[model samples]
Target: MSRERRLTAGAVAVLLVALLGVAVVPGVLADPSADGPVRPGRVSIAESPAIAPEEVDGATATLRLHTRIGHAGNPTDNVSVRFRAYDAESGLLTAERTVELEELTGDRSVPVNATIEVPREGGYVIETVVFRDGRVVDRDRTRVSGLAALGTEVHFTESEAVPPLSVSVASVDEEANRTTLTVAASLTNGGESASDRLRVEVVLRQAESNIVAARQSTTVSGIGPGRTADATVEVTVPSDYNYYVDAAVYRDGVLVDTARSVANLDPTETISANMTTREVEFEVSDFAGDDGSQEERATEAAARTETATATPGFGPAVAVAALAGAALLARRRTRQ
Candidate 1:
């Protein structure tokens, strides 16, 4: 072959090798998954229209959250932005707002504002969530501090006789094993002003020793004046002791009032001494005396009080004994 023809054949071979290299190597020229140099859908939260690190309690403040969404490749549509403020310690939601946009062709900045009341002086968390097509695309959170300050306060005179907040142990249900107690508590806002972020706590404690056995808490939103709310809590406790159900009410993180009710679970009439076992056998007569007088029974019940290691089997046995004793006592009274 002539030199020029040979050179032409060499050039064709080099062109074929270059085409093969492009097919074998990925991302050599451009990324197929990405629309351009940047991602098609992007979201970010901005720290502008800044919130004060500390604010006065019981005051309302305007909170603004700024968000930026970018649609680089395809037109992102139907986007949502949400702002939520909550108590960082209690995890109670204080305020919330949402903004919706139809469609976005370029980068867009969306600003949302919410009026939040700082009920109590404490640390709080502000959160922002961005959603697209019902899916969360971005989330951000910041913290703020609430400071106590002198504000317009209302004082009720004793002569005025405003209804006072009250808490009561409505009912307590013992499990078959007696190891668990489900307590229903009722709270009433008797005062003239409304209460927000009210918390109710149920505690199971030994009557004589005042040792706490179990406790749980529940929260309620703003309770209007003269309104009532109910909450239930289940507590796991040690068995074979007389306990008292104590219900405590708090308004704006301050203790208001507390109520106590008796829970007699002692197998006093039948079991004279402490029994160290998974289960103890007792008779109904152990709780009552021969006279069966109300005062005598109370005295005997108090004298027989003893503390023993609680077991799963012991709770059911004690519960059974207590029920049987109550039924027998009622029957004897009827006979008289």
Candidate 2:
């Protein structure tokens, strides 16, 4: 052959060899593998609307996971799901099986099932990540709590430590046009661990009926082992009449205990309709103080003076006369 013809033939031969090598290569057209988190649109991860414990204990809990994987437009398949469980503080727990998978749906999706075991826990959070077409498509989390050991067993079971919580009219400050009452109650933790953020509620009920009159709540975060939390919460009752009050304690939104207080009405014989004013004495500790220190002399003097001035200063004679007049008025009203 001529030099030009030989050169053309060699070039064609090289081109043909390159094409043959490319054709002989392994299956490179296969789709990429799915892994990691699921991002919206890129892929869809459908997790159990709810995560729950089949059974729970200090050592382990079986958590059931329901999930789906898919893509928006294309029918996608072979999605990968990663599952994990952690304590309340978010420490990861080891799972017997870490991976789950589902086939692409007709609309491009699949379903995956997985079970997780919780080791030991104060609280546990379950997380799921769905991957579709080799990319993360969706993510979700669920929370579950373990039993905490508290001094008192209020929620775990019913017991007397669950003292009756109550509210009542302890006294009436006619001079101040206000009524004060003691909010007394007790709570015991009935758990293996201490409870935090314990809340107590006192409900003032309408006397002679079960209707709630007024509501008040108090909370103390720490209640330790075999311990009782006590307090005197006072509410100002505008009226001198008696009313029913109910009280209860709650832990983590659960009512653990409750109790009631005797309603102490104002002394009607001492309170007269004609006398528009009266005096009231509050405990020295009633005022807010860090160390329960007594109020300043000046403050006490001012409070007492204000109380004295509000009521008539009728000596023994006037008191006797007023008593007689009140008795007669009472008799007449009863007769009417």
Candidate 3:
């Protein structure tokens, strides 16, 4: 080729790489949480959203799609969340629900679960959109299947109360470094009739050692539709030690539901059950295998990129640079 043609070709390749780099460098460097990339003025998802139904009844069932949202800025305000359910195969809208939120604080991520109803068959794509000031800031979607297999589950389930079941350390008495805890399990009946008698068991374990500190079980009364009931029990445990309050509900000799709470009495070492998992951005999931965390995968990708860039003759940029250099040298040789 002529020197002008060779020189022009090299310039074009260089320009292409520069443009591609401009489009990609920001995503590579941005700090992303489990849900998505956290940016100022942009509300990001915290982690993988879950679509679950406590029970399926008749032709349709009620389900919840939980999305955790947060931001890097000083907390978010005037947020409204819209939940949309689309048919997995047909891509048609099945159901939609919107819930108004007071605020999404920056200190911690908030789980905004949308209640939606759809036919108790086929798969669905559940999407959650976060809107601030009537404009969408962030959104996430995930596929859910096995709806046809979720047979008629127990009608009675835990109430909507946060941490449906909890154990609180009672300050009534303290002797020999021991304390009493009142464990309460909340139950709500969403069925058409009264619920069946169920059993709630509250077990406490040492936070660090996981030793059984105290355990008790109580019977929760059958509740009427839209009514809530609590089964309360008292247990004693060693003071100044953290404990995990594990509450489980059972009916007809079958375990139905469970909830967990943390009672951190150790003032020096407090903990929580809400340590949300931070996932790598743009992770792929098949809903079957546990191939490891998204964050780990992202880190591995970064490591590979760094290795390629540092080593010789590995990355595309290096190969492209070599090509451009050869073209330029060839053109210069023709001129000489």
By TM-score, who's the top model here?
3
For model 1, how does the per-residue alpha-carbon lDDT over 183-247 read when each residue is reduced to its tens digit?
A: 65655556576655756787876555556767789876555676665566776554555666777
| Residue-level lDDT tens digits of model 3 in 191-269 | 6667777778888876655567778998865587777777899987667767778887766544666788788776666
Candidate 2 clash figure, as a count = 38
Per-residue CA lDDT of model 2 for 1-336, tens digit only, reads 899999999999999987787689744433444443443344655445356556544345577766665557434556667777666675756563556454443455456677776554367766777766566667777776642321235532234555455444577655444567777666656556676676778776534333454567877756677665665577765454445566776655545555555454544533222233334443333222223222454477699999888867668998899999999999999999
Best by lDDT: 3
lDDT to native, each model = 0.58, 0.58, 0.71
lDDT (C-alpha) at residue 302 in model 1? 66
Against the true structure, what is each candidate's TM-score? Answer: 0.30, 0.33, 0.36
Summing lDDT over every window of 10 consecutive residues in candidate 1, give the lowest-scoring window: 149-158
Candidate 2 is scored at a TM of: 0.33
lDDT of 1: 0.58
TM-score of candidate 1 against the unseen true structure: 0.30
